[model samples]
Every structure is written in C-alpha cells, then in structure tokens.
Target: MEYSFGPLIDENSKILILGSLPGVRSLAEARYYAHPQNKFWKIIYGAWGKTPDADFDARYRFILGHGLALWDVVKCAEREGSADGSIRNETPNDIPALLAAHPNIRRIIFNGGFAFAKYKKYFGAPAIDYRKVLSTSPACAGRDREREEMWMEALGRSL
Candidate 1:
C-alpha cells in the first residue's frame, strides 16, 4: 500500500485543496507536488501574487501562510504507477474529521476530476461548498496559464 503524507493544515486555514493521491515524485521527496513538471506550486503562487519557491520548506510555508490546506483524497492505495487511473484498493482520507477539526475551512477544492470523483464516492457531497479545478500534474494536457486561470477563478469564488 502507498501511504499519503499528512495534511498541511492549521486552525486558520480556510481553503482546503485536495489531490487524488501523491505521485511517485512527491512521495520520494516527502513533499506535495514535488514533481518537477507539476504546475501546482506555480498556479498557487500566481494566485497569491508570489513567485514559486525553489526550496520545499519555503513553498510549504508559503501555502500555509496563505491559509490554504493541502492534502490528498486517498490515504492509502494500491497502484502500479503514479497515474490516478492506476489507483485501486484505496482507502480514503477521513475528511469529515478534518472538517470537524478545522472549522474555519469553508471551501474544499478538488485538484482534478479524479480527486473530485473519489471524494464524492467516498464522502458524498460535503456540507460545505466545493470547486473542482483541473489537475496541475504534468500528465494532464493543458496550457499552464489556462489552468492557472481556472484555478484562480475557482479560488476567487471560494474566497
């Protein structure tokens, strides 16, 4: 079983961004969106009017400082590869408990279709509103600017 990293959350976090699962690169680096080609950090930095940080710790701090929580929909899963399509025998994260713990979290944003679908399947419709954004993974086909715009729109709406 592949285990996901713990959530990057705090009491003040108002937005929760959930991905389907950590990819191989992220797991190896013990950081979210660690894959070199992934645009997750760039999109976030653009939304926040900040530049992407080269250092993992700085990037993580930047995310948390902005009151954004990061985590994955799956807690554990068996899969042949990093692709969400390869995921199977999955155990979902305890999102309800997370919500309870972070009452300030008013918006939950799924990072892609896979994250949204898995979340809906495992937890049903959440009490709070949610938005589904395009995946930031390099595997997904889209222009970075276009995807960033979509993410910004969703994040703006939630805020």
Candidate 2:
C-alpha cells in the first residue's frame, strides 16, 4: 500500500491542486512531482514568469507564497505501478473536512482526469469553483504547447 504525503497547505491558500496520488519517484523522494520528467513545477513557475529552484523546499515556499496548495485525492491505495489504471482498493482523503477547515480555499484544480474522477466519486461536485487540468506526468507524453496553455489558463491567470 502506497500512502500520500500530507497536504502542503495553510490558511492563506486559495487554490487547492489535487492529484490522484504520488508516483514511484515522488514517493521515494517524499515530495510532490519529484519525477524529473514531470512538468508540474515547470508549469507553475511559468505562470509567474520564473523558474523552479533546484531545491524542493524552495519550490514548496514558492507554491505557498502564490496562495496555492497541493495534495492527492487518494490517501492510500493498492496499486501495482504508477499508472492510474492500476489503482484499486483506494481510500479517499478527507477533502470535505479540509475544505470546511480552510474556508479560504475558493477553487479546486484537479491535476488530471484521474484526480477529477476520484474527487467526483468521493465528494460529488464541490460547492466551490473546480476544474480539471491536464496531467503533468511524463505518462501523458510530449511536453506540448497545448498543455502549457491549459495549465496557464488554470493557474496563470489569477489566484
């Protein structure tokens, strides 16, 4: 059973970015989007016309400073590999409780189809603004312009 990391969030956070769960590399490193190929940090930094720092702690601070928070939909799950298709017997995170506790969270941006689907399955439609952006995983293939535009639209515009 693979477990997700604790949420990188605080009372100042306005946008909650949710993924399905961490992949092998991220789990190994105990960080979000730790896979070198993942485009999460790239897209986020691009939103502010900056570059991601080499250090994970710096990146975490950057996200927090931007009023963004990160977490996963699945608290724990049995899965044979990183592919979303392999996920099963999943236990969901207490998203509703989190939302209630953090009333400043005005939007939820699912990091991919899997995260969005899982959120719907567990919490139904949330009372706040929510949308699904393209996955930043390397599994999605080809770091293309469309991905940039989509992610920029979701996170680049405003907090």
Candidate 3:
C-alpha cells in the first residue's frame, strides 16, 4: 500500500524533524508525539519554558513558533504491528519533493537512530555534504531523557 501524509505547517520551514514512523500511541491519538512516556513534549516545553504537560494545540503552537517542521520518514509501511523490525512492503515519503518545496530547510534531524540508519542510504549525497543532518533526538527511545534534552537544545539551535 502507498501511504501518504498530510502537509504539516508549510514548506518554508527552516528546521525539519523526521521520525521513522508513528508508534501505536501516536497513531491511536492521531497526533504526533502523543505518547505520554515519549519525552518529545516535555523536551519541547522545557526548551521553550512552557508547562511540560501542555495539550496538543499548545505543543503544536510551540513547534510552529520555533519554526520547526515535524513529520515521519515513512507515511505507512506494512508490519505485524508497531515494531520497526516488522516494517515491510516499504513505502517512503517523498523527501525529494519536500526538499524541493522547502529550500529554506537548512537542517534535518532524525528523531532516532532507527530513522537515520533506515534512510541514510537513501540520502544519496556525498558523505561530507550530508552534514545537513545536524543531530538525532533521544525522545525516540524512551530511555534517555538527558540525551533527549541535549538533542532538543541542538534542535532549538537549528532554528
């Protein structure tokens, strides 16, 4: 199946954050970073001095206010369920189209090592030129809040 996603914010965004794919929580909530245990919301709120447990609108506002673009690398891929390893019949998002539309995007940060490892091969750019990937976030794994904060700071700096 060909999985597609709706546009978030706009194409002129300067900073892009890509997750591998939505986990079950996010899919069920119909929201990005919806999992309570996921550090994504807390990290963003902490970075911007907002209440850590803000609602979806509040957090999305913060994301846009910071000129950040959020999305996943694969819109949809077949799988037994949520595990990344189960992903199959792979269909990736058209990143080239995004890049063409968002020339202002100076950096892209993968939300986890999984995304980087999965898509790095498709980058198809010279090793040195691939430095546009500024950093990977730690909120992805749910085990490293400190690392998440560091990457959050790096993401903030990119804006």
Which ranking of candidates, highest lDDT first?
A: 2, 1, 3
- TM-score of candidate 3 versus the correct structure, residues matched by position: 0.78
Query: For residues 38-126, could you state the per-residue lDDT of candidate 2 as single tens digits?
Result: 99999999899999999999999999999999999999999998998899999999999889999999889998899999999998987
How far in Å is the alpha carbon of 116 misplaced in model 2? 0.4
Candidate 3 C-alpha lDDT tens digits along 61-102: 677777777877786788665656677767667776777777
Error of 2 at 58 (Å): 0.3
lDDT of 2 at 122: 91
- For candidate 2, the TM-score is 0.97
> Model 2: how large is the Cα RMSD against the reference?
1.0
* Shift of residue 106 alpha carbon in model 3, Å: 0.9
| Candidate 1 regions with alpha-carbon error over 4 angstroms | none
Worst 10-residue stretch by lDDT in candidate 2?
Answer: 150-159
In order, how many clashes per candidate? 0, 0, 0
Global lDDT of each model? 0.90, 0.91, 0.63
